[model samples]
Target: MPLDLNKLDHLIAVAEEGSLTRAAARLHLSQQALSTSVRTLEREVGVRLLERTSGGVTLLPSGAALVEDARVLRGVAQSALRRARRIGRGEREMLRIGHTPAVTGGEVSLLLRHVAVTDPELAADAHQRYPGELTAGLLAGDLDLGLCRGMSPAHGLARAVLGEHRISIGVAADHPLAGRESVALADLSEQTLVVWGRPGDSGYTDLLVGHCRAAGFEPRLERSTLQGTPPVTHVIGTDRVAFLTEPPGAAAGGAVRVLALQPPVFVPLHALYAPHLASTNRDAFLDAAQARASRHA
Candidate 1:
């Protein structure tokens, strides 16, 4: 038999809330009624999905798997509804794109211009989103494409390397390295490297660190307290140096100086999207971006 979406929603609520009583309250149902619904669902599925205890409830392996699928199913349903409404209203198709902060606005605009060159009629809406938000939006069908740097694609999404950006160093104007025309990787061995995220937590940070290690130094890392700021700005008030993609002299009111790395390091620009969805506009954009990247290469 086909699974009931409402029951799946109830199970998700229980899983998220961690207590049947709380889940019932959130669902605006009595605890007994909610319990009965879950029991019925279990019977229908012919499996025990939850472990009951005085403290709360815990999902069994089967239940945990189902909950993960349930969220994706919910997102798919919402996406279908949205598409249907748009089609019913005779609205033009708009490609929605979300990108993480690692991808600058200038990079996005350049890609859009490339798309315009090939497909002038394609319309796109792009915005900045946190990494998690970008993944969730893509899975939910709210975003047709996601652009990021060194981000691993979440389950149900496909990723492609559209291009790469040369990495540069940014330091405060008064810093020792600021007056240099180019800074070598070894020159930064004594300087603290400022990064946006922790070493193990961010793939981009880990990749940069790996480069430093390759240059014979384990970098001294400092996590920037200022969130969502440009990479160059991270070194504005500190003596540390930051890895940035900005061109030389592209700093906040000249507070920082951008210098070329001696042995150039490049970070990949990746594009992610749901593989199950068919979007010609997304295909067109990816094709154009890849073509431009190949020409530049």
Candidate 2:
């Protein structure tokens, strides 16, 4: 015969509270009803799962062992119930999307607009985080989808490139190459290159180094954190140049100039998510983001 999980839950409640009276009150059932349920479960399991005392009750060794297993089953049952309820009201279901600084522009707004039109029943919420945080959130169930630049080989996450941006050089306005329309990759051989990202991120670092090496010289690489315009600050004060997709604060009086690189190198923006838990909303949003990105590219 199949075991009744509700009875198992009652048993767990009784064992945890150490009193049938209290368990009955907590479960909103009469004391007699709760007792009968426990008795039925004990008989079904063929052992006394609880020891009665004047003050309360305690679990027998058998009961103690079964309590842990029962808790697991009860948790699973509760989770299933919650998911079912959410599915029943599908229009209110929410998908949590996360992104790094790289994806906080028109592309995401366009994706949300598309979802509003195409998948009206689904709602999406967005959060901003660093690339490393985005990946961690995606794997840990904190985020349903993430827009980031790199992947973790260890996690083996499923990802797609949303779009690629051509990398350009950022230099102080007074720098020699800053006045030029575009600069050759070989010209950067003599200038120090600054790159900024999260502490452990090596994707952009590798891209910068590889491009430089391909141009017949290794770049003099410098690193910076994604703090308040530190990469721009470093470039403005000295001869160092930085690789940038846009001027960090050009509109706000930052004296940095963004120059296109000849024979352009591209950096890809990626969408990382768990394949096992993929949903229709996620797939649709990804498709919209890809289309928007292509238009910008």
User: Candidate 1: misplaced stretches above 4 Å?
Assistant: 17-34
Model 2 scores a C-alpha lDDT of 0.72
lDDT accuracy of residue 67 in candidate 1:
84
Score residue 74 of candidate 1 by CA lDDT: 72
Model 1 residue 4 distance off true place after TM-score fit, in angstroms:
1.9
Counted clashes in each candidate structure: 0, 0
TM-score of each: 0.90, 0.60
The residue-level lDDT of candidate 1 at 25 comes to 94
**Over 4 Å off, model 2:** 1-91, 101-123, 153-156, 197-201, 226-238, 247-251, 291-297
The Cα error of candidate 1 at residue 81, in Å, is 1.4
